[model samples]
Target: MLPPHRARRAAGLLAAGTLGLSTVFLGAIGTAQAGPTGWTFSESNSPITVPSDVCSIEWTITGGAGGFGDTNLRGQNANPRIVTTVVAPGDQYTLVPGGAGADHAAGGQGGTNTVGQGGGANGDIATGGGGGGAASLVLKNGQVFLSSLAGFGGGAGGGAGGHVPDSPSAAVITDFATTPAPGVAGPGSITGQGYACEALNTPPPAPEISVVPGPGQLSVWGRSGGPLGPGPGVAPVTGYEYSLDGGPWTTVPGGATHGMATPLLWLTGLVNGREYGVSVRVTSSAGPSAASAVKKTTPFERPGKPTGVSAKVGPSELTISWSPTAAPGTYPLTGYQVWAFHGDEVDGFQVYLCEVSASVHTCTAEVPAGVDYAVYVEGVDDKGNVGDYGWVNSAVVPLGDMPATVPAKDADLVGASGPITTVTAGKTVVLKGSGYMPNSTIRAIAYSTPTELGVFVTDENGEFEVTVTIPGDLPAGAHSLVVTGVDPQGDVRHLRVDVTVSASGTATVTEAALATTATATATATERLPNTGFSAAGPLVAGTAALGLGAGLIVASRRRPSA
Candidate 1:
């Protein structure tokens, strides 16, 4: 009674619904038949297998139970209700179970003939016995995630040993929680639980550190507090951080090898005489711990040497001066040392003359006259550190009173004898002189252009003879010679002389003559004093001679005549 097309469509829809229901029923039945497998850990380790069809698994893990001890001191319970998730698991895995801690025995009474029992060989005798920590549970060949508080185990109390007269009874000690069973796995959802889970995700505990003064003022030591133990759950301290004088913190890269007994870190480079505050902290994968208490210290160092040293010579004292040292601010200069030593003498000794304040750079010290002296200066710091000596400076002091200037009348200049008035250029002239300071130096300088000709030292009697060569370049004319003398005390005397220069090769000499005439008158005024026939005799003789000469002339005339 229905249409053919409509009836065929309705029948097709009903068949499809029936097939869908059957498929769902078969899937449910299969799932119900394949239940989750269970496993218990009796040995230290065991193997676990996952079903091939299973895609994920939920795990509940707990640590082993603790042991019992005397004085009602019960062992601690294992970590409880730890939940974890494993995704995509179809392979074998290894499971490790924790072992329970051992129980402690109480001490027995001591007496002769009856041995007394020793204290329990577990934990401290007075305090409750300690419980062993739980081992970690690791899942392999599968992606596993743990909830908070999944790895921690409680610690056990110490057992009471021998009873003491005044001490509290051993029964007063109370028991802690009992240990828990090992972990189990099943096909179920894994959800994080408990307040401890939230705590486990937080950063690890910070380490404790202490700093001590080292051998040198510039050095310090950093010590780390040993391993912090609350069970296997807490992370260990890995490295350290330090700061000096309120400076930025510096981190040490490597972790400590000995937990609480880590070696001390030797730090250097601290400035001397400077106040410093140091601090340190611990670090781990979870982050860094808070900074430790600050430690204060001061350093010391030697000062630098002084520079720019100089010495000024006086009649009886030496004035030493120097520039301020470029000392560091940490070790400021406190004073200066002035030393005097004999020139060219190193007897391993020096004269420490005096000390001057830092504000002053110069000092005066008395010295013997006529002696050469070498001087040095050094700087001293507050810490008793002395700097090296500065550069050496030398000076000589004058000895005695200076001689007076020679008077022109007291000195003379004379040339070698015959007509030696003239001199030629490039010829030697010998001269002599006296009346100068004995044992003094004399210099002969030409007047023209003030050129030096020669030098000589006066002998014991203050007299000298010197030969001087007229310079070829000297003008051929008259010139003056200036002579000077210098005594030991730096006094000066001078003398001057005039001389002429000639172009002729030889010296010329000249002579002059004188003539006289007399006349007489024949007046008989108290006639001339008696002379032995002088006047008349001379007249007669002259007449006779004349006659003879006349006669002879006549005869010659006649004889030229004979």
Candidate 2:
């Protein structure tokens, strides 16, 4: 007998195709070794005879091919088996290649009574099963040397092995019989026999999904693939699977309504302003359909409020400016919205000043004067989302908010009586005023309890004629009508007319002292009468007293002595 090390060396040389070295070891062991030879068998029940000079044999065995099933359900192929066995001269062995299974028939037989059975069939519909591979066995003087049982073929629409298929094992050497070990089932081993039949139902087509983006979140809207297939076995979508950014899939139950698109899922815990890819697949009893086309969207939030806001005021125009806000996300910043509130915070009126493009940081708007305003700014995204307002500056009174002059030095007003300065109380009268800013807005105000009567726009000659109605509720007292406007130099110009207010329906012209007190406690509000004047053109650059004949005409009314 050869030493154990020499025996191992012989096996290693034999596996490496070193036949000369193996022959040396075989000669040392007193056995003449034959040159290596390979054999392939496809037929069933073939016999293999070991040469008289051989000491070992290497065998490679393969199972037979599986049969095909109807509706393009092909059977799985078998796994190959390989082993090297120590043998004596003139050893006897047999090769039983499993027979190929036929469509709608029983599976091929394996060595030692192992068989792969076929699935059930209905009329012309059939399923196939694959054949089992040959087994490996070696016996010396009734003592076991190495043995491996053959594996059964796969069943139709079942795992790679046939239904109830037995497992195969690698060759082992022992004095007694070696039990076969279990293995993971081949492809399709866990499936039912009806797995192939379910293919009659068509898969769902790729769907069109919509996405609405929000702050660090995305809302996906989708619809069902609908019922599909030609026969009664038509499959309805039972669930849906979604993937985000090409990540793992998540399954969600399907709704009852089909074909109509609606919000179905919301993906959160995402970074803002980052784009992500999304896909969906519909599932049914038949399996999952092909994935839908990829759609991309980005989550975003409203822009930050503008900072460092400031404003500069002119006669009736305000120019506002601010610093840039935070950078935009998926939705770009479209513009900035500027707003202002007139008067004190308690009773202020809000107004939308203007909108400026995101590329710009400044904008100008037309604003009414005579009252203080608080200016604010906010950012707007491309999706029309508005941000919080940045209250930068307040109490921005325009240049037209100067003190009211009791009797303007460079302005004049005349009624139908031609410069005669007597007026009745609680009556309607037409008065023409000149010597003011060209194309400027003029306000008729009643004071000591300042009340706004009407507003009018001056013509190109700095003149305007407006019909005025004295307030009927005014107590019989001395009062003055102050016509205020902005001059060409952007200075406030007030034209005052002093008069006595009498009771209604009485033309009693009472001679009263000139009212000189000017207060801002205005309480009465009235609508402006419609003036039949077209829009004024560009303002003419001239003095406010251009048409004044003598510049100062003091009309004094005296009561005649009875």
Candidate 3:
């Protein structure tokens, strides 16, 4: 057979109309004018017939880069070329893009797109030089019409000196090949050249593996190096596979099969806090190698519950606080959740009060007044798992006398006294005051028994509004409530109010009046004061004697007058 270059040249001559052969038929009409169309040819060994109306073509051709070397001596890259040339209508042409050089033994030449020079080789002790990259070419009549020659790669010990294109963006033609194709021939054995190496038959060594635990998941990774050195294997590793608890092997995602070197593989849907055994192996054409030594890890779920949860009653709001000692599981702590429950434990309903970030220790929520409630706190993990609730307050009956902390000021008082304010025993009553030391704690005491009620804090204006419940067994009578706190000047401050305590569980009387009528009777008298009976008898005898004397005198006077 003729040499490769000579045969190509001879073929070109026959197709160019030089040897009286026309591979392309021309129209009888005169040369055609320019037409509106662009042509891009990329396939190797393929032909393109010039359009009947297109008189010329602006061609931009790119060459492929040389193959990568086994060592520091890399293959050189090829430069691209752009040219504008006149063409006859119906002329046949072929586009051949350059192929990348290969690092295989026997010094394989880059394929026909570009005629790459073959690489040189060493014995099994060292790898062979990468094949040189080929130049892109446009062929006519089997001859080279337009060609961009790329530099040959270094065979073994030398460095490559290849050229790079100045106008890479101007290239319109895609190169055909980057690596060697099937059945392509390598350089023939030459005298004094060492024997070429062959494909490996042994599988790759097992890889070193590690795992990180997450909530219900595990992240796994592997790298070359175990009982063997970093060389890993006699053959190229295609991928890696893993087995869980000695189960069937599963391929690692994004491994060499997906063109990744060392990808992180995740095992999900695992049980939290359960120990799992895992092993890994490398895969190659020879099949999977022995598994690596088993490693164990346990996945963690949500964090432990929070501690020291406490809720302070303040008017209609509860000031909640907690400790974060156990707020995070394996993951980071995200926040805390507060819940308020009303009624008894068996039948009550709960309300989501508020949520505060892990960094904050306190949260305030407005709640309904006068009801007994229990506040619960829980930790939230970054994975969105809420831990068990921590019970700080089991029976917190919010009263009207509870007040929130405020800033300190001067000594003062409010509603000291007025019309007797009536209050029922064993019920909540709101009392407001001002002018104590701001943000100071105070106590309310009920008299005349002087029994202590509850403690509270003042507000920024040195004011306070608190709820207090009276004692159930206190006798029904007038009483007073006194609140005492520290003044701004460190003196004791006191506020007092007079109140009438109704009978326990009863309403107080509202009216006050007096009655002014006598309740005595008189006895009847029988006679005049002293000597009553003798006086009556003498008066009667005198009346009779006087009548007798008067009759004798009248008889004597009548005789004289006659």
Considering every candidate listed, which one attains the maximal lDDT? 3
Q: Any runs in candidate 1 off by more than 4 Å, and if so which?
A: 1-267, 275-298, 343-348, 400-562
Give the per-residue lDDT digits (tens) of candidate 1, residues 435-531: 5434444555665466656656556444556677767777655555555553222234445556554555432212111111112111111111111
Q: Assess each prediction's global lDDT (C-alpha) against the native.
A: 0.41, 0.47, 0.49
Per-residue lDDT for 548 in model 3?
A: 16
Each candidate structure's count of clashing pairs: 17, 7, 16
TM-score for candidate 2, residues paired by index: 0.33
Once fitted onto the true fold, the runs of candidate 2 whose alpha carbons sit more than 4 angstroms away are: 1-207, 225-234, 245-248, 253-262, 271-274, 308-315, 319-323, 326-362, 368-376, 380-442, 445-562
lDDT of 3: 0.49
Error of 2 at 392 (Å): 7.7
Q: Which candidate is the best by TM-score?
A: 2
Please provide TM-scores, in order, for all candidate models, with all chains considered together.
0.22, 0.33, 0.27
lDDT of 2 by residue, 1-562 (tens): 1221221101000022222313222222122223454432322423444554454455443333344444434444544444443454465554333333343344333222122222211212223343433333332333333333334444444223222222122121111222223332222110000001122255444445666555667666665433322233334455678999888889754542332323457677878778899998776666667787888977666667788888886655668899988655346788877766543322234445777789898887665553345676767777665554566444333333323434443444445444425555567765565655455467777665766677666665556667788676777667667677655443456666566655552333333223322211122223232111111112111111011121111111111111
Q: After superposition, how far is residue 526 of candidate 3 from its true place, in Å?
A: 99
Ranking by lDDT: 3, 2, 1
For candidate 2, give the lDDT.
0.47
**Model 2 weakest lDDT span, ten residues long:** 188-197
